[model samples]
Target: MVSLPSTLERIRTRLILLALFLMPWQTRWIFGTDTLSGGISEFGVLSFFVVEGLIVLAFVLQPFIEHHRDFDGAVTLGWVMMLAMLASVFSASNPHLAMMAWLHVLGAYVLFLNLLNRHVKPKEALFAFTLGLVAPALLGVFQAVTGSSPASTLLGLASHDAMTAGASVIETFSMRWLRAYGSFQHPNVFGGYLAVGLFAVFLFLRWDVSKKARMGAYAVGALLTATLVLTYSRSAWIAFVLSSVLAGWLLFLHHRVELRRVIPLGLIILFVMGFTATLFSNPYVVALEETHPGREVYAYQPVHNLYLLMLSELGVIGTLFVLLWMVLIDRYIFANLPRVGAVGALAIGSALFIIGFFDHYLWSLWPGLALVAFVLAMTLRLSEPGVEKE
Candidate 1:
């Protein structure tokens, strides 16, 4: 009888893994706009909601049926963030949209930190995440190389016209380059996703895995880095560089890796930067730069600054809530840095802080936000040395 229940629990854990793997590819359907034509677009994704339902159900069942109750500070902070979001909705210009946004963010936080963390091993969860990114990374590489992506439409992936006259293009001194959108609304968002995947690959490589597994991690890391470069997202580029340097420095300080090994990593960084600069010098990139200022926020001037965007959309109280959330994350990372490993802690921390500065994706985009939650969950899990099963 006990064995039967254990078997059922294992099955449930597998289902959770399947749902997490597919969450990134879930598509949304826009029902209506809050205003006649220009306000918040109300959207629904049945699969997303279904997955959230399952995660919440598992969380609820665990405490009662399994007699499990293990709550951490991260979970508490997440609930606090949810409450803040609820309060912010009252002052939101579009309360319905605000509520919906809160639900999405809360759902992601619960799915990763509460449910997935309880069921899966940290390494397994990280591997599943890296697997989920493979398809999108390949799509991005193909789009960048071919200058088009008809496959995105066939696969129901989100994409914009890269070759359109006024589309998303990067202009350099002499050329214009079409940025790879992959399965995201923007190249910057795609870049952010790849950056996280790259970090996962790095962690996989550092693990005491088989040689074949290490080689696979290397391949995946290279591909992800390539697509990240093709994204031409200045924010992502800056974030990756800063995060890598910080992580490397921490590794050295902790003596986790020898200083001599860091030299090759430094050379690789230089090579990547040099290659990206060459891409930026293309004629198309130059043309776009000369013609397009690349600042467009809902038809007005682009507010590239994330803090300002949060203030405008979420108001002062909501913005303060977000700032508080960031402070908590920083505290958690610093407090657990040694246990989490310098690479894991600094990589995720830098990505969140650096990317948050330039883009609203952390606040608005579901996939980007979900990645943040996943990284945080993984960091917390890694800080502890064993599987957190009850």
Candidate 2:
């Protein structure tokens, strides 16, 4: 029978998994939205505060109870990022909003780097990630097919009022289709989550798990990939293709696998690309071809690059800090790549960098930032001794 202490530990582990699983869903209370002019406004989410508080409590109590100590460069970078973000709040247009955003970053850092890596196993983390994608993936499929979803006030999910003929969807190819947003603020953000989940599922497949688990991973991957197509996020589509290739190549290098095995993965990516091209008439795709005017609050021409967005919003010094943090974390991951294996690191990093070059989700969305933290934690945990190797 389990001791009382062991039972309590088990409960803590389950809560950590639950928090990780809910990271992507934007069910929250919006105090205000950022204006085009880079004003920071308060945006409160009950789930964010609750989960983060629990993580912090667990982190603070763990040393006294469990007497465990582990430290790495990734963890150091995470703290640095939190500090940088807090400092940047002073110069933000809305200091209140900036402070709130910093809090969210803090939560992400603790949950992913502190709680997840230290307590959760790699397989458990992967299972949580795959489970997290299920609701959004299914919702995306439904939105694509029906062209709308009812707003759920309790869940904080908005309706599809913007997906009209000339607004979100395009009518150029004698057809119209709604882009999938899932429960996110935009279709592209949802696609970003799916892109990351795709890689996570790929990593899961390489694990020495049961046949049933492998099959489940395959099903999740398929659902995520299909919904990603419906999102019509050109940046995400391109990122997925590039990241999939990098992951396959890195796997081959790490395992000395035969080229034949990698070919099937490449073919699948090609098929996804082909399907994306069939939706060339999507307004989001068309928006890429033309120079659209920037929304009033943003104060710049409509540009997709995340670096540019950071520069515009955070200014040179803040942007430098942000970039430096990214570099440091990335360096830490690659430095330990031999231990962690390259598939997960390369796949997630490739997708983020590629999509980041063409989109601003990572810079502007709290959920996007959280996803990055989660990926980094999962990557670091997978590198530890006793974890499976590809």
lDDT agreement with native, every candidate: 0.64, 0.66
Cα displacement (Å) at residue 39, model 1: 5.6
Task: Report how far off residue 74 is in candidate 2 (Å).
Answer: 3.0
Residues 1-390 of candidate 2: C-alpha lDDT, one tens digit per residue: 888766667767777778668765666555555553554322332234344655666555452232113345545655666676677789877676677767776766666654443456767777787788899889988887787877886665777843464335533434556678887878888888888888777666656678777666666766787788888777888888787777666666666553343354445645754675564445454543343445332222356788787788667766777677667656656766654344576677778888777777776667776777776666555554556642
User: What ranges in model 2 sit over 4 Å off?
Assistant: 1-8, 30-71, 161-167, 173-175, 254-303, 312-317, 337-340
TM-score of each candidate structure, all chains considered together: 0.81, 0.81
lDDT of 1: 0.64
Residue pairs of candidate 2 with colliding backbone atoms: 36-297, 36-298, 37-297
Best by lDDT: 2
